[model samples]
Structure formats: structure tokens, C-alpha cells
Target: MYQPPHFKEERLDVQHALIQAHPLGLLVTNGSSGLIANPIPFALDASASPLGTLRAHLSRANQQWRDFDPAQEALVVFQGVESYITPSWYEAKRETGKVVPTWNYVIVQAYGRMRAIDDPEWLLRQISDVTRHQEAGRPEPWSTADAPADFLAAQLKGIVGVEIEVTRIEGKWKVSQNRSDTDRQRVAAGLRDDAHEEAHAMADLVETRGAKS
Candidate 1:
């Protein structure tokens, strides 16, 4: 993550919140075959480490897990609200015609040594936690316990548990903080009018930053 001073988000609470909101992470690792990345949903356990620990699962058929070495480091990237910022949304564009388009987004990169667990008990708990977290917002939540014992057991056998004790985390929140108040406000307004989830999310974040200033 190339984090400029103005864009870096160092607050632990904020970082955790972003990870929670964006549970899916791109797990990246290097092996003899070369670099491989897989998108996996993670469960965060803050108590596991100062930076936090990530829990996930990979398909047993996925060679990346088998190829991954415990001694090597892996990176998990979590992306939050993101949207394109057009020059038309900037007041400075009209004032000086110098502003160009850019992007506003939030992202967190976690680096740590990954451990692969084949224990059925650990796998059960890991999948249960992930399902519970993701299903919480639904009108009718689903659970691993909903399946029959034999069926769930067979399903669990097809995956392996993954855990990472995070050693480092980098957070970047590029939310128009570099722009003037007027320009930032205009950007927010433009995003809000776009009527897309990501756009509205970015707009809210930009507006929140303005309020703090």
C-alpha cells in the first residue's frame, strides 16, 4: 500500500471497523510456482494479537494452501468503500481547471505468517464463525448447524482452516482529504447524487472527514 501521510489511517479502531465491514480479503502468497491470490472471507479476532488475527478457509483442492509455507509471509488485503472521483465534481476544476480525476477508497493490508489447520474441530469452528458473521444481516440467518451431521461433516472435509497472526497492518483511506473544503464538499455531493452504494459510501466518508475538520 503506497500511503501518503494525508491518506494513511493509523487508528486501530478504524482499521478493525473497516475489516469488519469488508470481511472478504484477497489472500496473497508466493511459492515455487510463483504468486497466487485468493479471495476469502475472514474472521477477525482482535484478542489473538496486537494487530489482530485472521481466520479463513480455503478449498482443499486449492493448491495455493498446499504450496504455502508456514515460514513465509502472506498478505491479506481488505477493500472497503471505493468509487471514482471525477474532475467535474471538484470546485477547483472550475476555479483553475487543474484538477484531474482520481479515486477515493479505503483499504487495509495485513501481513503475517499463515498456519494451515486440518483439524476437523478447528475447521468446524472457523466455518461457523464466518457463516454467522456474514448471515447476521439477513432476515433469516443460516447456520452450519442447520445441515445434518453427516452432510456437514462431508462438506467440512472439503476445506482446510487458515489462520494468520497478523504482524503488520497498513490502512489507507483516500477520501478527498487532499482537496479543499469546498471541493471536498462538492465531491461528496456529487457522489451522493450518483445513487450507487459505493458512491454513497464514499460520499458519507468524505462528509464525515469534513465534519472532523
Candidate 2:
């Protein structure tokens, strides 16, 4: 998360939105055994802390959870739109041959002390929230209640829930903000032409950043 001032997104609202929009994050922790990271979906619990909290579950067998002591800190990285920026997309660079390639993207890093939530009732609620969030745009929505009694009980045994009450957040949004208007527009157009989702997303961000500027 080495963000230059030109690309740093210090807006609190933007940081929260990024984390909420992208629930899946890479949770990294440093404990007695050293560093460990896990990619998991987390729900934002605004009521839990002043800076808000994260809710996620890891498999009971996963050692990553055991390493997260209440006294230690962990980093949850929430990544938004990202894409490669080609030099050819910049009008100024194309004309003068002055610019090289770069990347445009948005990311938020949440640092906090991790806490394990072992209560069965709370874990169930957290699981339901996560499932609903992930299945938002699906055609056929699934639910924890859809499964049977014994089956659900057995399923719950394999998982453990945890929350990281976010103490610090750092946001980065590199969306061609440093580029000239003409070049930015060209970059947006070029991004739109790209076949990948991330490229199109970057194009949208470029447009939004331009509008805000």
C-alpha cells in the first residue's frame, strides 16, 4: 500500500465504500510464527466500533485464525477496480513519446486487532450476512435456512467466525488523476475498448475522477 500523494484517496466515505463494495479481502497477520494471509469475505459491522468492524469466518482447521491474537494487529486489504494503463492510451505520450506504462486502480487497507467470535448464534448471523451479500446478483438466491437442521449443524462445526475492529484505514485510488484532461479522456476511451472487466471498471473510475476534478 505504497501510495503517492497524487494517488492517495484520503476521503473517509470513499474508503468505507470501497470496503463495503468489495467484501472479499486478503487478511494478513503477523504473530509468534510470523506472517500468514487468508482471502475471505467480510461483512462491515458499523455498529461494532467507531471506525467500524469486519466480520468473517475461517475454517475451523485453518491455523491463520489461531495466530490472530487479540493483542496483535492484522491487515485486511479491500481492492476495487484495477487495470493496466498503456502509454498508447495517453494522447500526450502518443504525440510526444514522453510517458511509459503505468496502472490505475483503487484499494483500501484496514488495520485492526482481530477478535474471535465463537458464539454459535453470532456465527450463524455472520454466515447469513456473508451468503446474502455474495449472492446479491444471483438468479437463485440461497440461504442458511434453506439447509436442513442436522446438515446445518454439521456445516457450522467446520467454521469459526472472527471480527477485526478497524483501527486504521488507508485508501489508494490511482485513476489517471495526474494526467492532463485530454490524456485522461483518451485513457478512459482506451480502457472502455478493453475486453476485461477491470479495464472497463478503470475507465469508469477515470470518468468519475475527471467529473470530480
Candidate 3:
């Protein structure tokens, strides 16, 4: 959460959209016991609202769900592509004696209060919707009816559904935004040639975001 001005991402709409492309977020909440974090694959519904909506489920027996009091806000973290910045990538460092290691990546943070969905039918609907979303481009799409009604009903009983209506979001795209154009170009080119897959990912992020401006 400690982000410098140079690394902060200000485009809210675009930020929201980016995370949804990979909506598996780390959900964190706090209560009397302590802080709890759950890595959940979520269904992000943009049409739900300007702040968007998050839908996910957890094991019914998992006490964490009950401890997620609606009064206490929750944080959902969507981690985008990231890569390390090698010292050799900086053209400025090649001439000047100023250089260090850093990382470039995109991440979105969503804050909101969570509410439990008690309606089994609504939960079923959400489950179906999420399945469809994930299997959108798959040749063999999976449907909710894959399981027998009795089986699904029993499975649903073992899970607790949740909805998080986002209240605030912080998007940070730390891709050498503060660097000079020449420095950025040098870094991008170097990263593109990097053997590490993560490095190439960072290069692509820089180019994609840079073009927008």
C-alpha cells in the first residue's frame, strides 16, 4: 500500500477493467481474532455498478467467513503482471553512477464491506454465472447442471457465498512512469530481451500503458 507518486495509477475505469481480466484476488478482512486473508477466484461484475461487484464463495465450515463482519471493511488485491528491473536495464546507470534494483508491476486494491448471501438460489445463479465467465472461450463450456441437483445442493451447503460491493479502489501501475522517455525506452528494450518470462511481461506492460498516454 506504500506507493510513491511516480508509481500510482490514476485511471480508475481502466484500472477496474485490468483487474477483472484476472479477478482472482486476495481477500482480507479483520475482526476480534485478527486479520484473515483468503485467495479466492472471484467473478467481477462491472455492470453491477461503477465501483463494480465481487462474488465468491468459501467453505461453510470455515470460521473466517463468520468473522468477516460487515462492519469491518475488506480488501481485495488483484495482482497484475510484474517483473524485476535489472540494473543493466537502465541506460542512465550506464553513464552515471546512479542505479539500483526495482520492480515494475500493476496491482489493484479494492476496499469494501462484505455481506453474506443466504439465498441458495441466488448462490446457484452466481455459481453458474462465474462458471460461464471463466469458460467463455473454451470449446467445451461447463454448465451448472453438470452435477445432479441433489449433489449440487449438498455441495452448496458446504459453501458460504459472499458479495463485496466495492467502496474504494487503488490502482498502481509501477512501470517506470517517472523515468525520462529515453530511459523508459532503454529499460523497455532491455526487458524485452531478458530471458526471464517475467521481464518480458514487464516490458509489455510498459509499452501498453505508455501508448495510452
Candidate 3 CA-lDDT value: 0.83
Q: How many residue pairs clash in each candidate?
A: 0, 0, 0
Residues 82-193 of candidate 2: C-alpha lDDT, one tens digit per residue: 8888998777665788889997878999999998767778888999998888788899999899999789888888889888888998998889888888888999999889
Candidate 3: which pairs clash?
none
What's the C-alpha lDDT at position 136 in model 1?
94
Provide the global lDDT of candidate 2 against the true structure: 0.86
Predicted structure with the largest TM-score when compared to the true one: 1
**Better model by lDDT, 2 or 3?**
2
Model 2: weakest 10-residue lDDT segment is 204-213
lDDT of 1 by residue, 1-213 (tens): 787888888998899999998999999998888899999999999888899999999999998888876788999999998999999987767779987889888999999999888989999998888889889989999999889999999988999988999999999989988888888889888998996888998898998875323
lDDT of each: 0.90, 0.86, 0.83
For TM-score, candidate 1 versus 2, the one ahead is 1
By descending lDDT, how would the candidates be arranged?
A: 1, 2, 3
TM-score of 2: 0.92
TM-score of every candidate relative to the true structure? 0.96, 0.92, 0.90
